[model samples]
Target: MAVVAIDKKDLLAFVGKALDDGELARLVTDLGMPVEKITESEVQVDITPNRPDMFSAEGLGRAISSLAGIKTGLRNYSATDSGVSVSVERSVKKVRPYIAAAIARNVKMDDALVKSLVALQEKLHDTLGRRRRKVAIGFTDFNKLKPPFTYKAVKPDESPFIPLGQSEPWTPARILKELKQGQDYGYILEGHGQYPLICDSEGNVIALPPIITAEMVKITPSTRDVFIDVTGTSQHAVHECLKIICCALADRGAQIQSVNINYGKKTLTTPDLSPLKTMLPIRTVNKILGMDFTTEQIKEYLERMGHGVEIKEKGKLSVVSPTYRNDIFQEIDLAEDVAIAFGYNNFEPILPQFSSIGKRSPSDVRAGLIRDLMIGFGFTEVLAPYITNRATNFEKPMLGEHPAIHIKNPLTENFTMFRSWCIPSLLEILAASKDQKMPQKIFEVGHAAILVDGKPVEQEKLAAAICDPKTSFNEMRSIVEGVAYELGLKLEFAGLDSHPTFIPGRAVEIIMDGKPIGVFGEIHPQVLNNFGIEQPVTAFELKLA
Candidate 1:
């Protein structure tokens, strides 16, 4: 969360009328602003990350008007096909695939607009596009640039251009050093042999993706119209960047122009905007919130959100959402919008319409009993993160043949895989406590991952481990059976099973209700050595059913 101080005078001007104290408070709350205090002159607002569009006063004002029904029509940005052109070359296809551009004409450039543009670009770069590695945007003064701009990849030493904030023309590699944006932000593509650069047909460099642009065409207050370019490796990402930039420019009252790019045999256009139809079920709205509103009330709420609701023969409302609302893909989303428009505070907080008592499941009850039993047996409970390293999750000997869910975009390697079992994590805790004296008894009651029919299924289980010089497999099994008996759970012991991470003759599987729930084993000397554990260890697990 970030707190941005919106000028009170500026906000009032955009708000269009003086708001009373309660009305202002409702306006702030309706716009989802966490207003700490409201004074006679200014207001302090807290903004959330998801609503980057609300960072600007224009966006916030528009949202307030839409909710208040002051504005009931959809706003569209008209694309002006008059100025600027960008051409993609074949050389950059393998390095960066897609590019999109729009021309913003007659933009009233000022200090506030410039600061807002720069801040919006940086925020979008970091949040939506991962700091422009996935997508990058470039803004150039249209008056200075020649027609038909070329976006291509060339030799680092062969091209030279004056980067933004620099006084002299430098080669691609040298520009990385002079601009100071290359080493810090350019490192994303530094390992590649060739860099992604954009230039005009006359070999004049424009920009390096995820880095700075040339100063020759920098946007200034004197500039009236500008050319905006977005480049990325993914076509979908490039289109999203275009939408973000197009919307931001439209806020400044810019007339957008769709640019055509030649990609081998295919020709693509910028800002390929489309309108989508979202259906809202009249019955669903009534059921979810227990609202007694008729279909007419629902239709009015939809209209308030800049949507045209048409009642079909089936009695469902067909709400047409503007193309800018790419997030509304489901009926629940439409219901949420209706709720917002209806006013969250207006809804009465009452008991459930249908009387149904909440109760714990059988598995939950058994798991709780096991946890309490373990605590009574002089065992301390420990809870570890559900995400763990691959080395501890899969490389350990006592591990089972279960697939772990991997994070696609993990921030660190340690959180790569979801934990399949709690036993391996317990071993890590034991290793960390090696310096302490003997008689270490620990227990964990948590969820574990298991693969059933090729899909992951999470199950609740309880595990206990005792580390001492004299700990044995039978001792751990006795504790498990005792806990199961106290919970009125029947347990069956299977034959010794061979596991990669466990001693061959010392391991047995625990079965409950004809389902194999857990395993009990003594720490193998070789496995103990692998974990740097010198003392004997015993562990057991039981699934709560």
Candidate 2:
């Protein structure tokens, strides 16, 4: 979460209706903004990363004001045309293409406004810009730069130039090191064999994006106006950051100068905020909110939320969303507004309209049976993390497709991969317990992930492992067969010629009703050696259904 300081005057202007301390606290809590402290002049609200729009005091103020009925409108402030030109060279398209810039003119800079601008830039860079890789922002002393800037890629070892906050000039690579952003974030371009660089027409370095900016044009309190430039590999993200900065500055009463960007034959305006419309069936609103409001009532509610609602038919509503509200793409989202406006507490809490009671599925029943059988067999039931380390997941050399979900933004390498099978997890437990006893029997009934037809699906699975030196393939198979027999299931085996994680000749696939349900095999000597386990091991896994 990003903590933003709100000026008392600005806060009051945005949240028009005065709120008592308790009411203000409740509103902050409801909006997920934690009020760190309040003074006679200003209140500091902690804004979350996902809510980039709230990074500025104006945005937060507007949100609270609207909710409090102090304001009944939402509009993107119209931008003034500055006629600044930014040209995208063809050579940079494959490296880093997109660029957007906006000039904030006639703004009086003070400590409060300067700090707010800097804070907003850092927040957007970390959150929406994805730490500057997908989007990076550069603020220039508008008085220092010449108009019609150029954004393009340059050599990694390009000429040494001073970076923002640095006194000495350093090469691109050296600049990365001196700025402390090289080894950490400099690698984003290492794989591409090029680095994204920003410089003035005279070859003075302005920024080495995603790394550091030149110290020459850093924003300061003396700077009355600022030139903000965002460059990135992702056009959409770059444009979004542009809008974020533009809106935040507009809140401070700075006039926005739109810059025309040339991308081949197409020309686009920076900070573009065009209106978008989406239609929804009125019944959806009624069903979700349990409300019976007329179409006019719903329209009024949406309009109050900065949405332009039109009656499409007797039971359909068309919603025109301001360009900044990119989160509202679905009809149900508008329905939510209807619910909020209708008063969530006003709806009668009736029993489910349907008479039938919710019950577990047959698969759930089978899973319970498997759980009981495992416990009855003296096997201590264990549960493992659904997400597993990539090394454990793929290094095991398990046969069949790797099963596990992969996180897009993994906090660490240890949790990067999802578990496709339970065998590796059991093997991990066995490795840890080697010092405890000779024989360790454990069973786990949980979900395993797999990709089916390009979509991820999870299936309930049962896995059991015994780590006794005497454990063999037949012994594990008997336990597997016994569990199936107890569940009124017939099990048959087909020879498995080769399996990576199991002894090639000792593994067999378990078949039930002509469908392959599971596998039982002796742990391959190579697999055991990898985990530093000396005892012979056998493991089996069966699908719950």
Candidate 3:
């Protein structure tokens, strides 16, 4: 959640009328942004992360007006062709690849407006922008910039400009060394040879983005027209943030003009403000809210909550949500809007009819018992993340390319897939703690997944490892035998050979019900070298159920 302070006067001005203190609090609360405090000059509200639109006074006021029945339904925002364009060069493709831009003409700027805009920009950067990792927003005085613009990349030392609040020009390398923002976000471009830059036709730098904008085009009280630029790694987030800012400026009476973004091969216009169309089933509304609402009542509630609704079929309505509303995704989201419009406080509370207590399942009980047994055996339990990289889970363990679940768009190289077994994770623990004392005994009771016939099958697994100069395969085998005896089960150990992850002559497989259920062995010297573990290591892994 993001807490924002809106100037009371500015809020009411965008609200289109005066609202008393009580009315203001109640209205904002009804609109889902709970008022933190209502003071004479400002109103503080906690806006949910999902509603990035409400981070600004203008957007919050628009929502208040809608809930107050002053102005409701879908707000139509149109953009005229500004005849200005930005050329996106291929050099930035491996850096910050996407850029979305627009021009808001006839913007009436003031001290309050300037502060609000700055606050909105920073709020967006901290929240929706993922601290500028995914998105970054920049604004400038439109008249100060000479277009068409170039959004490209350059060597860090090639271009130099005065960043915002700085008087002297500094190269991108120097800025990252001296500026606070650069210090906080320079890691985003740490290993890159070039940095993302936006400049005008005259070779004047506009921004070193995800960091700071140039000072030459700073917005001021006297600034009339505003130029907006959003750059990011995610194309969807960049475009959505552009639409949000453009719509907010439009609410302040600015005329939004679209700018063409030219990729090497194609051109596209930005700030697409067309409302997204989706179907909202009437029965879904009734089912979720547990209230009998007729089709007309539902439509009215939707419109009151700022949605354009039209009867579609026998039981569905075609809903058009405002472009600035990034929260609506499905019929259930529309249903939530209807509930908000109907007033959540109006719903009567009732006791649930069913009577049953919640308790852990039998599998959980067994897992807990095993964890206790490991702790009693003087082994510290280590919980590792299920998502591990291929190198650590497969390559380093000397089990090359075994099937497991893979993440489609992994955020980083370290987290790419689910572990197929617990031994690799236990080895990871020992690898990270190599500097600790000689004796390290650890255990993990978790789930591991493997692909069976191209489908994932997951099972609970228990793995334990002992790392020391004196540890041996017999020690791990003894611990496994103790666990089996505690569980009142008979197990047979069979000599195993040529296992890739274990020493060929020192491994044994445990058999139960005439089938091999587990293995305990001295880890292979090659595997130990892969993980940089110098001491001898013995480990065992088995299915719990």
Q: Which of 1 and 2 is ahead in lDDT?
A: 2
In the range 461-538, model 2's lDDT, one tens digit per residue, is 899998998989889888987897898888899999877889888999999889998898999988888777778889
Query: How are the candidates ranked when ordered by lDDT, highest leading?
Result: 3, 2, 1
What is the Cα-based lDDT of residue 534 in candidate 1? 77
- lDDT (Cα, 0-100) at 451 in candidate 2: 86
lDDT of predicted model 1: 0.74
Supply candidate 3's per-residue lDDT for 451.
Answer: 98
* Model 2 ranges with Cα > 4 A deviation: 1-10, 30-50, 89-97, 309-318, 374-458, 463-542
Residue pairs of candidate 2 with colliding backbone atoms: 163-215, 164-213, 164-214, 164-215, 403-420, 404-418, 404-420
- For residue 271, model 2's alpha carbon misses the true position, in angstroms, by 1.6
In model 1, the runs with Cα more than 4 Å from the true position are: 1-5, 20-22, 36-50, 82-96, 153-160, 169-180, 233-237, 310-314, 353-358, 373-444, 448-454, 461-545
Error of 1 at 197 (Å): 1.7
Q: What does candidate 3 score on TM?
A: 0.77
Residue 35 deviation, candidate 1, in Å?
A: 3.3
Please write out the lDDT profile of model 3 over residues 1-545, one tens digit for every residue. Answer: 78998899999988888999999999888877778999999999999878889989889988888888898888889899999999999999999999999999998897777878888988888777877887899999999999999999999898989999999999999988879989999998889999999999999999998899999999887888999999998888899899989988898889999999999889889989999899888888898888889999999888988889899898889999999998888888998988889998999987777899999999989888888998989999999898898998889988879778998634445777998889989998898999999799999989889899999999888899999999997788889999998877689988986688999999988889888878899999999999989899999998887
Please say which candidate is ahead in lDDT: 1 or 3. Answer: 3
